[model samples]
Target chain A: MSLLRILFVVLVAYPVVLIMLGINVRHRARLPRRGPAVIAANHNSHLDTLALLTLFPLHRIAQVRPVAAADYFLANRLIAWFSLNVIGIIPIRRKRERDGDDPLVACYAALERGEILLIFPEGSRGEPERMAQLKFGISFVAERYPRVPIVPVFMHGLGKSMPRGEWLPVPYFCDVFVGLPLKWRGDRESFMGELEQSFHKLKEKLAAPEYL
Target chain B: MTRLSLPPQVMYALLGAVALLIIASAVVLALARIRPERDYTELKLRIKTWWLIIIVFCLAIAFHRDVSLVVFAFVSFLAFKEYLSLIPTRRADHRVLFWAYLAIPVQYYWVGIEWYGMFIIFIPVFAFLYLPMKMVLIGETQGFLRAASTLHWGLMTTVFCLSHMAYLLALPDDRNPAGGGDALLFYLVFLTQINDVAQYVWGKSFGRHKATPTVSPNKTIEGLIGGVATTTLLAVALAPWLTPLTRIESVAAGVLIGMGGFIGDVTMSALKRDIGVKDSGTLLPGHGGILDRLDSLTYTAPLFFHFVYYLHY
Candidate 1:
């Protein structure tokens, strides 16, 4: 990792993890020690990526890359540099309007290197109180890399913390639930349904009446 | 006084704590060996944690006043952060919450500068008037009152109340005769924690009737009486060396701290109950969180600071 990445991890990541979000990662055993896996999470805000990135062990952060929207992340020079160099994110075009290198190829390359690929299957931010429909992107990746385990990550309170269009994030309590990883044993449609259901189950468990 | 010249009371108290820690460690070791079958592991962990906290606290105070102030500021920040994280906040309050977080350092800065006037009124007057106005400018009124009040209460308890400890240390030394301002803080913290531990032990040993069954079921009338009596006696014994208070005044201060400490602990309990959380957060190993540890200090610090300031300073 570069000096700036280390600085970002220390300054940005640790503060957001330890101070701001007070992020409690649950079922950490589900996180594969060695990865050629897809970390599929539900999206709520831009903070979702940062939360997941910081949740990984510092040594493993170098091997982790979040799939961010190309137009938003790659538009500005400073942000592009920070996102690409510091956070080490892979930008996939949302509208597919830009004629450039394929996003999936970058993801495949990371997977080929035994790195962990973080993808938000919802493809966009939504009201965190509810989950959005899962896109076929995860299914597409799972089919190609059938050997890779696709882990479903369910996050709560990121939407309230740094909801869409909000510059300053309130430090709300956030819990990231890492569910059991599923293998590519079923069809794409069935697998996507299963993944979405897994998130719902985790969300329900988190919202259960049991107090802290 | 220079950095090296600490009050005798503070030094003695630190030494006393070290002595107690050694005895406690020996007992824990003995318990482990004697009753290996029984689970005394939690007590052992709590004692270990206490050792760490005592060492860190003594080192901070012993180093310099600036270091102690910074350490207290960090404590207030942690308690404040934990408080904000535990509560349910609205989306519209994000900007206002940022302002609330900013108030921590600014409030502590007032202590560092010894600006008593600004320190007293900044949160109660200026922030109180300004935060709601900022929220109004955002043009969201759906839950405006709730959001504003929640943030304000959080500021009052976490930052405003806790900052009194820093302010206590900043008091003019001439007003303190027996010991300097640092000893006063140490006395208050040590006595308040003893009061808490006494209440728990008494409650477990002799308590039957619940004091506030719904709010804090663990607290009982028997425990309250026993704890307050024990703490008052301890306070009277230690006051001559640690504080400028006369014997009668020491008794009064002990009663204030014991009663106020109970109120603070129960107030936090009520908050946790309202929020549907068993503990504040998982910050410490044995203790629940910084908030959990400092709950009694929250009430006792401000009450004791004002009492001493009014009578002496």
Candidate 2:
């Protein structure tokens, strides 16, 4: 097992699993229990990290790596070890700054390995309800690995569960909805355009009164 | 002058929390009763969130007076968060932006530890090097120039600028416990807000010529001069009660805050013009989001902090 996968189970995924059940976890989309899939989420809170994990039985999976920023989580040796190896996070350098080449390469490597990669299409995390401009990185990777199914994931009630800077996660019962896996038809631009629309469609699905 | 020998902080933030919450909640309730709530849920949520933050700040200060500085740091973090969320940022610069985000807490940490020498320039000089280096490393030949500049601008506007006020509490003074930081906070905040109100009222009531028509149409020279004069006179009278500054020094402080505040407002107005928004957020009942409340402080905090640091620290 990759060090990143172990860290994910022990540190991130465990707490999420415990909390999801604690909050009476339910899946409206009713995703399959097992699969090699790529889950993309809305960008908004730091807690959005664990919020997505609440939907997956992460421990059962052997190869899953969530893409995180190299600057924040892996800026130092200790945090890097925890984020990159233990938590099963692939540190990709954000192309915006002058320093993100290594992480982008790592992301490509993880996809080639057939890992259950978590891609944040909107890039920076925070507002799961709104879809802003998304980086084509998810599409870029998917274009290379056509077999990997890209799943549109959205979490309701996360904005209140843990806002920015509040260390303690509030006892708000948030729900997660994973849409059907979106299969790419091989054209990179068309796939990305469709994926962006899929993200909004899932958000609209979660935003309905039934999910609340 | 008598100085009280208490802990590092008196930790009266709980008192402040209660006062602010009642005030904020009352405003929200009154607004909801008078206006349609459904049309403005977004505004209500923002205020509620601000109220929650204030409550958390109070609890943190009351519990750990020694680390009450964290509360101010947290405020800066929120203000920065709100500011960045509205501003457009590209993915190519995410690595350095992360550094910029982390810089919020670290900048406030320096204020908590009272490290002025580096805290003063952490964003401008060091962050300048760090942001460029991060961008350079990405090796993306295109958009580096624009992205790098925006990243630098965000850090300067948000963290470096906002952290100055929190640093004021660390001012080396012989007057009171907490080094009169609370007084400095009240004094500056009160002055900035009053100046804003006074300018708006004066502009609305009187005057002919616009201050800058393009940058800020609501601003008028008559309003600026009248507000500054009125705010300066008020500071002269209020200084002895709220801050340790002398009456003359208080007048100077008032003038500084008044003028600095106008500049900050116009600067934000310019950005808003670019982004095309009338208010930063519809959070406060009559007020806007954290950005609206903080816009003046972005310019005033650093200007005022540096003033006291030179004359009073």
Highest TM-score, which number?
1
lDDT of 1 by residue, B59-174 (tens): 66777778877787777777776777667666666777788888888998999999999999999999999899999998788877877887888889889998998888888887
Give a tens-digit lDDT track for model 1, residues A1-212. Answer: 45666678878878886666677778888987778888999898878888887777777777888888889889999999889999888888766555764557778888999989999988889765457888887787888888899899998777777888887776666778899988676589888888888988888667322111
* Residue A65 lDDT in candidate 1: 83
lDDT of 2 by residue, A1-212 (tens): 56456566667656653432222333435454554567787765666666555555656455656788777887788877767555667777776555533336676666566566778887775443345688878877777678767877766555444444544443323446567777879788888788777766766643222111
Worst 10 residues of 1 chain B by lDDT: B279-288
What does candidate 2's lDDT look like per residue over B109-183, in tens digits?
Answer: 777777788898888888888878887887765777867786677678767887776676666646533336656
Model 1, runs deviating above 4 Å:
A1-4, A96-103, A128-130, A207-212, B32-49, B282-287
- Indicate the residue-level lDDT of B166 in model 1: 82
Cα lDDT, all candidates: 0.81, 0.65
| Native-referenced Cα lDDT, model 2 | 0.65
